[model samples]
Target chain A: MQFWPWYLGGVALTTVAVGHWLLMNRMMAVSGRVTALVNRVRFGPDKAPALSGKELEDALLAATLAAFGDEALKAPPTAPEPAPEPAPSARPQLTLTKPQGPGMHALFFFGLAIGGLLSVLLAGGLEVSPSLRGARFEALFDGPGRYAVLLLGGLCVGFGTRMTGGCTSGHGLCGVSRFQPASLLATAAFFGTGIVTSFAVALLLA
Target chain B: MADPPCPHMKSCEMYEIFTFSETLAVWKTRYCQSDYSRCERYQRALKGQPVPVNLLPNGHLLEK
Candidate 1:
């Protein structure tokens, strides 16, 4: 079968990872900026930069942004802005607090891992492929080995996706389109690792 | 302090916000894939966080 889908998926995922990383830098400036935003809103517009409606929401999103490990937010903000009546009290805290430890970051990674394992089993073991498994990948292994390689490859995808922050869909699709430098770096790491890993596996199996 | 883990549930951080970002950082995701059908599925999936997106070889669906 044509290995095109895998190839497309590979390139696309990389592009997104790269793009999103750059996007993060854009979204979260130095933590001080966050302080300035909160200060203006809480104290008064006259006290500092006025918080526009959009600015407020964007600031809230950043504060609320839990995706991609950001350790800075782990500790509670010194002076958090009061939440709107409609919003819950914890709203500001959850988004802005970064996971302090690697353990916290593991959740995102584990999520991807579960997703990867699911995809691998769905397409690999169950043999639920839209297309036949390509010969280039298959030639490296017989029946049992093929399944092993495929599953392992899927795990790698998940692990790598976690380490870099954002999976193929996250960085490759969403990020690359947005022109994020972080995503760009992540995409490169993904491709380089994937190619090297795939080569090592192919050689070992051969 | 964060919520304690319940007996039945694993220690999962509920979808809640802790702090706020000082900057107005906007993250846009671009999806490229053969299935235009799943575009909506993906769009819906990526509510505000980064998600996996499959793009075509040269389908330019994203720009600054």
Candidate 2:
């Protein structure tokens, strides 16, 4: 879309997803591999693997760029955090708590539900503009069975997020920015599976 | 070749003055909880592991 807002919003989101991976020294694997990293960091090296500087940069860039919004691109030095405590013992590290079992997970699902509810309510409303067409309060139900689909979409999104350990918002958006190899693979796998499932469902529903 | 630990890792006072605090943060937070997960150094060095299923080049793309 030529819409600047959508493009900008996407960038903002990506930064958030990938930033932690970059920081954590792990590849941004959306394939539920982050748990491995987290275990190592919290428990011991026996649990997870570590990352390299390049990998770190990739992850942070991915998440920070996507989630940091326009502000980060311009003002990165503002928030100088204190140095973190060193690990009690040395081990390869991966995974971060932000993208996993946290409020971020629930927020993603909430956004999906709201999007679906909006779509259903405005199914047949009206179109104001190309970019703003979906923004109208009444046009939520403009499409055929959009409400039902959105509700279903919400469930699908939630399930996918849980299964993948993160959603597009989690892995695709944030995971990639950090240059997480895992995130890259996970995102690819998600897309690949999504495409196959889409075709299957298309034929079934057709 | 065996090298001494990065002098930064030896004592708390020496660690603080090191130029690689940012570098250290990446590895340290990877294995931490609650707040610090941005440290890639900690994750890979202290808390990481190999992927169970190889998803890299040889695994899917260049496989025989």
Candidate 3:
């Protein structure tokens, strides 16, 4: 099969993980990032204000004042006068007390989808197919049954990742690279589980 | 205590002004992705309305 070499793929993944840490000062873990985004979305506008909007602004203002002295807060003499305030009733009202929904993680998740598409294009198009008795398996779990299994699997994966506090990308890639003991343990569990599951499935089929 | 000016209002502590349900609602919307589709913030963005900073999680400011 035509495929990217494992070494090259490893190098690319390492670069991405390192870049994520350098640029964002964050672990490149998709699950955690998604979880954070989910949390922000579930919380309503009332909680939004506390998520670093005004605090960020205040911090910046304080930094500027400290760096340049009180003069930084003063308007430049050449600056134009602020526009007259509109009547309160005439202004557009915002429900600032409500949750704002997904934040920047929206872009991250969206970018992940885009990246998948880009990879397919770069790889000269991907030919997807099921593995190991595909037709027989489809016949047995056709239609809604197949969907049910897929959904169940997804939920299991999500639950497992949350309970473990990391996923493959978080533990196997970022965590292992960092030499974290927890990540090493988790990665070992992942590999062991995969091996056991494969053998179990093979036995079942036999 | 009187509420601070909107510009000066910072920190999650400001949420105290809201009713318990209101605060809970915001919290649920932020942490629960399942309710995202029905969220007012998401709906407004869909309509091209400007969303304030508190609604967006801290991360790369795609547009600044």
- List the global CA lDDT of all models: 0.41, 0.43, 0.56
TM per candidate comes to: 0.31, 0.30, 0.52
* Residue lDDT tens for model 2, B7-51: 213212212222233443332222222222232332333333323
**Candidate 3 stretches greater than 4 Å from native:** A45-102, A126-140, B1-64
Each candidate's clash count: 47, 85, 28
* Candidate 1, backbone clash total: 47
Model 1 lDDT, residue B8, Cα: 13
| Model 3 interface CAPRI class | incorrect
Expressed as tens digits, the lDDT of each residue in B1-64 for candidate 3 is 5222222122222233221222122322232323345444445445534444444222212111
Tens-place lDDT digits, model 3, residues A1-206: 35667898888788988997897666788887776566455653323333334444444344344444655545544445745667767644332333324565677788778877777778788655443336545766766777787778789888888877789999999888889887899999978998998788667765
CAPRI-style quality class for the chain A–B interface of candidate 1 = incorrect
The list of candidate 2 runs beyond 4 A from truth reads A1-6, A14-145, A195-206, B1-64
| Model 3 accuracy (lDDT, Cα) | 0.56
DockQ of candidate 2 (2 decimals): 0.05
Q: How does model 2 score by TM-score?
A: 0.30
Candidate 2 lDDT tens digits, A119-199: 445555333432323333224445455666667777886677656556675567656665766668878988998899877
How accurately is candidate 1 docked according to DockQ? 0.03
Model 2, position A5, has a per-residue lDDT of 51
* DockQ ranking from best candidate downward: 3, 2, 1
